[model samples]
Target: MAAAAATNVGNTWINIGIFAAFVAVTLIIVFSVSRQNKTAADFYAGGRNFTGAQNGTAIAGDYLSAASFLGIAGAIAVNGYDGFLYSIGFLVAWLVALLLVAELLRNTGKFTMADVLSFRLKQRPIRMAAALSTLAVVFFYLLAQMAGAGGLVALLLGITDKAGQGLVIAVVGGLMILYVLVGGMKGTTWVQIIKAALLILGAGVMTFWVLANFGFNLSAVMQEAVNMAGENGEAILEPGLQYGASAVSQLDFLSLALALVLGTAGLPHVLMRFYTVPSAKEARRSVVVAIWLIGIFYLFTLVLGYGAAALVGPETILAAPGGQNSAAPLLAFELGGEILLGIIAAVAFATILAVVAGLTITAATSFAHDIYASIIKKGQVAPDGEVRVARWTVVVIGIIAIIGGIFANGQNIAFLVALAFCVAAAANLPTIIYSLFWKRFNTSGALWSIYGGLISTIVLIIFSPVVSGKPADPVTGLSKSMVTDPSIDFHWFPLDNPGIVTIPLAFLLGIVGTFLSKERSHPEKYAEMEVRSLTGAGAEKAVAH
Candidate 1:
């Protein structure tokens, strides 16, 4: 008992020290970048000058944070085949962006995603809706990050209670808001790059450890997982087990893979990163680099996940710092002892911080560039005023996210992140896709796509097993499960992803809305479209659109 207590105390100091270090580093970046904001463009879009490699690293840095490094590893640790499914999906979605959205989004829009779609329509309503949709995506995503961070801090620092969640989440929120409100994209990008490097290096080290200790044999790892789960019976992976052992397992594998692939294409935060680059060609190359980097990272994660299952045991993960999310740290500690474990914990924390930084920047930039300059300001805000509003909006949005994260502290980060993807795939993606490709897509259609998709996704989630039924249980102080039981429950949707369902609805709404609205078609618009798609011409014509 005394040894356990002493160990806990030591972990606590490490957590505190790591948290303090991240906070200090973020503040320095923010304060330093705060001084040089001479223009709104620079503040909101990183002056649109990031190199392909830098932006690519930043992209990987942004996309592969809490979800890729921790959530994926944790899911793999707990669920036999479900976690690896996430990795496959995540990588596939980049293709959608690369082949479809990348050039068009860059070729058409100057800054925000709304600029691309709303260029030919009324900018105000479009910008407002886009900002709201962006906010919704970022809000849930931010919660996931904070939740992960709080969980990491709690586990690594040995604060396992619910309040520990709140503490760490608040710390992350505070750190991220400082990055956006003070530094903008420039400061945020650097932090993301640093974190991405750390995450990749850490995963590489962990993979090496796994390989050296267990040889480079995949079959051995599988056998070990099956045996361990057999020891538990209630577990998913164990020795001698095969993939797709049951119907639920198959559904989980398919649903997770689909979410990873489609979710990446529709994610507003990721899309907005493309807008931060200067030209369409740059955007295209940026994704190529990201694909390579992200590919390597995900590959390493597979080893880490199987390693956790083979060596650490599933039950031990549940008893870890933050449920399944602690798989990476738990594995590190088991394999490399306290010092290596602490370093992994710190790298994970940095990953969370880096991701939150990008998210806050994306949402804040939309509010500044899309809503404020285009909607609220009616395109009248001066250059200086625009940057100022963006900086201010950063604080306001950050505060809201912080408060929300505080409320959602004790929950699962992966579940919340999945929820965010469902909404984005439903709401923003359909509208953006149609507006660019379909010429007949009118303003009314765009609005319906945004509004309909957003409403359906949220309502479904509120009724889903992850966060459904009652709003919140008072006596129990836990969210009432939408299903009678999360385990033996029934849901309208097959899996957590609302994309397959909601994406179709968004397209349907867009078609109906565009058909109903009798807006006069501009003949010159076709000529303009050809130019935008072909040669990236009509440069002078670019405005908020």
Candidate 2:
């Protein structure tokens, strides 16, 4: 027992040491890049200097959140094959971004998603609508990242106190703000690149360890997972394990798949990364590279998930502080002991930091460039002034994230991330597609799509089982309601994800509003927009630092 106690003590120190080293390296990158962010262009778009590979790596880092790394593994550990569905959906979503949106966005957009929307539409109203949708997506995404950060820190660091959790949230919030304020887009990009490399390396190591333990035989690992699953062993390799086998469950799964597939094309942070590349061609190339890297990473999650179930056991994982979020770390511990666990934990922390920083920058850019500069200043704000407002907006957004993280503690990180994707798909994707494709799509249609998608997603999620209803405990079959102390469950929305309904509704509203409006159609401007979007004519040039 004494020997076990000593081992625990040593493990804790190793974890702390690795985490501290990661933090220190991230800060160094931030400070080193701080000097180059003198212009609004540099602060917002990395001066368009990054190679496709670099930007692709950063995109991977930004997209692969803590939920992807830890939460997905945990979900698989608990739910088996159903958890792998997320991986397929998420990877397929990049094809949408690649074929439909990537090049057009890079060619026409300046800094934020609003820039792309406002190119041919009435500038002020379109920017306002785009900004609203951008903020809506960013808000929910930020909440998920912040919440995941707090939960992971509390769990991995062995902090049991509420105050300790709050501190962790604040520290993470502060660092995210610092990354944006000091390093700007360039700094954030480099940080993401580094973090992505570390994350892939760590996950690769874990995957290898999992395979080695099963004699490098995939079938052996599967059999082990089956054995560990007991009576439900066969079900572990089937689809109905997580979402159930009902009509509603099928619809829910479809909705979730829709969100994961369409959402990536619309997310503000992910779209904003296209602006960092030099040309539409580079933007296209970046998505290809990102697809490869992200695809490989999700494949690793599959192995890690099954490995955790077979090796770490679900009871041990569920009993951990962060539940499913602890599955990967716990698996690391079992396979490679404390040092590997610590490395994986630190990489996960870095992943969260990079993602939140990207989100903050996108949100801040929307506020400063779209609302503040385009609307309030009527596009007359000096570049310096715009950049200054962006920095301040980062601080404000950071504070909100910290508070939201505190309240969002103990919520399912993966569920929150899915909600964010649902909103993005419903609100942003339709508008983006119509703007780039349909010549008759007017300001009214843009507004309708953005507002319709945003409002519907929020309302549906609020009434969904994920938010208001009590979910049945997997082991005990007991309902644990999150709504009220008296357990008032009012979840009329059968689907946890709103994308299946909301996405089509958003597209329909855009089309309806466009034809109904008496506003003059902008075929001439659309002609120009099409040329620029297709040929990269008059695209924003990279500013020299």
Q: lDDT scores for all predictions?
A: 0.74, 0.87
Q: Give the TM-score of candidate 2.
A: 0.96
* Cand. 1 Cα-lDDT: 0.74
Find the number of clashing residue pairs for candidate 1.
Answer: 9
- Give the Å error, residue 18, model 1: 4.7
Model 1's TM-score against the true structure:
0.89
lDDT at 165 for candidate 1?
64
The ten-residue window of minimal lDDT in model 1 covers 1-10
The local lDDT score (0 to 100) that residue 518 gets in candidate 2 is: 90
TM-score of each: 0.89, 0.96
Tell me the tens digit of each residue's lDDT in model 2 across 395-466: 999999999999887666666788889888988999999999998899999999899999999998888877
Q: Lowest summed-lDDT stretch of 10 residues in model 2?
A: 1-10
Go through the candidates in order and give the C-alpha RMSD of each one to the true structure.
4.3, 2.4
